[model samples]
Target: MVVDSRSRTRASIVESAAKLLREQGADAVTTRAVAQAAGMQAPTIYRFFEDKEALLDAVAEHVFATYVSSKTLAEDSGDPVADLRAGWDAHIDFGLTNAALFGLLIDPARGGGSPAAAAGLAVLQARVRRVAAIGRLRVPERRAVELIHAAGTGAVLTLLATPPQQRDPGLSAAMYDAVLRAILTDAPALPTGDATAAAVAFRAVAPQLTGLSDAERSLLAEWLDRAAGAV
Candidate 1:
């Protein structure tokens, strides 16, 4: 089919760009180079990608998709904290292995413009939500996510900037533990805790409660959020 053919062509172009990025860094992924690598004319690259920036975004996403497809997690870890640790470790490993892709993702100029960067953040957010569900999260889910993301990204960039022999191997785990100490309570707050802790625990699973109507759930979420934030 024409549609299938077009999809393959676009994928081929992205693949070529990704190869260039990995082999020679971000600056090597020029439109002409990608076109030649994919055995297509330069104008054909434009047909698939609006410009060089769009093509670079596609390449970042393509590389990320391939990397994530190779990683897996247990269906239910029974300990969401452990699951969070695993996710953090995997993220660091991904960054260290894919230095060029990681640099593209964390560049301040790109901000959140890259689809792959958003996807990576979404994965982290989900992992944080899982931690919240178990009532172990001390901070609100959003704050926890941001803290962990920033720390992990910082840790990876720090390591990448260091020469391999000089890199501090313990830095990533140390950073994760530091953030965990700030975010997770000793135990689930649902059973015995102050109102704020209880609110945090309840807010984590409030969406799944069948008895609450949509409006009721919305109101409850607002109130719980307030309760969670109250000192």
Candidate 2:
């Protein structure tokens, strides 16, 4: 089938580009190089991708999608906070292991529209939601998500900028702990005196408030979110 053949060709091109990126870094992934690696003409690459940037985008999405797939397939350990920590560790490891691809994925211009990046963020959002549901989250779910995402990104970029031998191995763990202290509570349940924690916990269950109409539920969620973020 023509469609199947096209799909295979596209996949081969992307895989070849990914290989170049991983082994030799992004500078080595030119159209000529990728085409030679894929055993095709450079013109064939144009048939598949608009330009070098487009090809790089494909490579980023392909590699990041594979990583996201693995994360999605992992079983949750039942402890939401522990699960979040595991996700953070995995993210840092991925960034270190795939330095070129991670750099591409984190670029503001390209990453803004990337489906793979969005999928990764969705995974983080789910993890944060679970934490909020269990009453451990002290901030709003969105705030918690933003804080964790920013911290993880900053940690990876910082580590990548440092020489490997000179990098502090404890930096990532320390950053995670600092983020936890900012966004989470010591108690497993909502504490009576902590209005922010109560608001966050309530926001977690706001969707399931079936007795309220949809508009009422939305309004309640808005109020709770505002209250949670007030701290």
Candidate 3:
């Protein structure tokens, strides 16, 4: 088994590789590049990771860990629709908060024989199973959870992709509002304006959250604040 020191070194290398993969596409990520970024020698890098593929597999696992951490699904509340709205709000907040990491999760390249992807997919599957228990899935297809998940992802991507200077936080909040509309089977309409307003609206609804309290929101907000500054 790898000792603590060796394991730390390997984890550092994998983290550097994953960050690079998100910032620059996979083609630009080489073991040598990772070693240089991690401030280690090529042979030392090879000691932990066999090749770019192995490093990528490790990166996939690391990325999936973040996905697992970011599961914001809300269930078991008296109203499934309310639970779903809370879930949508959480999905938007987390996605906007971790835009790059979110991209890695939805990227199609990580499919097929990828242990990292399989682990992440497993988490998603389990979350969907909970939704199934809540009877939130559409009838005949049982894809309500899938549909809700996709809608949440799509709204967040649209919000995050827009330049903060060009658009405004209102757009992001609106996107999230639309997601709630879809999940609740209601007509789509959302507030619009600036990010400050969006932030205010975001905070205003914290009490209504399912399975999450204000303390949890504050803690999560602090974590996202630190991470958002890193980008």
Candidate 4:
């Protein structure tokens, strides 16, 4: 089937805007610049997005959509640390690779400045809740979620801001060691790579507990792909 030009134009404009935000700062994504980047007129861009704020929200949404890529996440159900290692790896990988998306996500001047920012953040926080519910977080689940979120976000932000040469390897496990470890006190009886290790330490079910539709999982996988190997 032939694609619709208007829909194609709209996607192109949002993509261009996201590109500009990533390449520059969020302040740089004017409709005119996006239109220019899209090879369309400014009014043509306006026809799709209501205004710059709307465009920015779209950009933010797109950024999130990019982070949760598929590929099945190869989850470890045994050791909490193993599950965490996988998640932390995935999380930071997304953050560092999509610096532009990361910028829009963490930067207060961009989507963070908008009223809708809380909604976007809540979407991510909810994901952490899923992980916390896994058996490893024996302490209050809420605090475990908080610690994990703080650690994951902090690590990603630090990685994004820090020069590659200076990033800390120890920082990678900081949240799990400092926070979750307080609850899951036992030194692992199993090895990190053992197939049963992650499961032994964690709940049988996976952490992304939205009962996500296959479509959602597929979208998330694509986003993870953008994060590439940076994490």
Candidate 5:
């Protein structure tokens, strides 16, 4: 019973903090303000969170987890490239809609060890893996993942810095296209004479290579990844 009560209280505090963050931005999420919003004393927040930063971390994770859940719930469209584009669109929309939370999630100091941020990256990696498996990825999976992630972050930060009325609506799409061209091949299957694409295709299937020891598989993956990155 005590555990349940504590969980409820913690959840209430996080929800209240999330609401403040969503509506009024991060500056408005002071402990005193959050406590008042949650109908509790400021000290009660200390009982649940170590400091304002900790509370904000919880709020970020809570909100981002909800958003991630929505992404996971959606049915995949069977086209890996199209599915990746959809994920990118959703990411941009989420960043725009939750500016304060997005800012918090992207902060290098805090985001480095954040589970929420890691989960988001994992989703991107899965999408990239799907593309690699289909022989469309030209670069290594890790390289493709990094390029897409960096581009998306740059696009969101750029748009957020610009005044709403002055922002270019085509900027995100253009960035995605540029990233796709860098990381993906025109052909749906691995093209002959394209060493990078062939390496990437082989890397994608390395895990399922039969008759190979685990260490052998790992070495093969490393070699293939290096070959893909060389191009």
Candidate 6:
């Protein structure tokens, strides 16, 4: 792939900002500092990014991609719950090790606009879908995804806010177990499984079903919701 000069410059700027974040924390990633680190003038950064926040967004994206690339999840492990556990562990580790970047990505002001944050959510949704496919999810897939995300993010932020020596080492694990207890079935979905769990699993993959009109799908979704609530 031929890397153009403009792309190279943008890449250098993002790299510089990422380095600043990783080494000096979030407060140190000023536009001037990033420009100097990248061996470019301050105005050059403006030409690439609208503002410092934009630059930080790019830096978060670059760092996230680099991290995810190094620890790419397997496409499938034949056990969706196990895959979910692996992903939870990786997410906690990533947040702890990249506090500055993680904070930037998880800031409520950014909502779901950050590319890195969206990518992380997509991964969670995919993992949840896998569990739904096997009929083990006890909650709607979206609900399960949201719960896991909230729990994982909250756990990391809480731990980060505490002094290292005072932090409970079991906090993250306990949170994960709590989330699992709320969202998963004791056994895989079977022909004679809990109706609520099975309904929730079916709801997760409902959109992928074929030969259904929009109205039919909507009606089916309502029925699934009612069924899932029976638990």
Top-lDDT candidate index = 2
How many times do residue backbones clash in model 6? Answer: 0
Residue 18, model 1, lDDT:
86
Q: Of the candidates shown, which would achieve the greatest TM-score relative to the real structure?
A: 2
Local accuracy by lDDT, each model: 0.82, 0.92, 0.58, 0.61, 0.90, 0.85
What lDDT does model 4 reach? 0.61
In candidate 5, list every pair of residues with a backbone clash: none
Give one digit per residue, the lDDT tens place, for model 4 in 1-231.
Answer: 246877777788888998898788777899779989999789987777789878878887766655543313355465445555566677777777777666666666553454344443454444443443343334433444566667778878877678989988678667556755654534334335432224322332333546888787656544433332112
The candidate 1 region of ten consecutive residues with least summed lDDT is 67-76
Candidate 3: list runs displaced more than 4 Å. 1-6, 19-30, 70-83, 112-141, 172-231
Candidate 1: residue pairs that collide: none
Candidate 5 stretches with Cα past 4 Å from truth are none
lDDT of 3: 0.58
* RMSD of model 1 against the true structure: 2.4
- Residue 110's lDDT within candidate 3 is 52
Q: lDDT by residue for model 3 over 1-231, one digit each (tens)? A: 459888899889988887787777677678778889999887888888778767776786777666555553324565544554555666677667656556656767855565544554454455444433333332211233456566777777787778867656676457656544443322122224333223323433434566877789777555433432311
**Considering summed lDDT, which 10 consecutive residues are worst modelled in model 6?**
67-76
**Can you give the TM-score per candidate against the true fold?**
0.88, 0.96, 0.54, 0.62, 0.94, 0.87
Tens-digit per-residue lDDT, 1-231, candidate 6: 345988999999999899899889989999889989999899999988999888888888888977665445556678888889999999999999999999888777856676656676788898888897788887777789899989999999999999999999999999999999998888855436488777877887788778898889988989998887732
Total colliding residue pairs, candidate 3 = 1
Q: Which sequence of candidate numbers ranks them by TM-score, best first?
A: 2, 5, 1, 6, 4, 3
Could you tell me the lDDT of residue 204 within candidate 1?
82
The list of candidate 4 runs beyond 4 A from truth reads 1-3, 69-81, 107-135, 187-231
Candidate no. 2 TM-score: 0.96
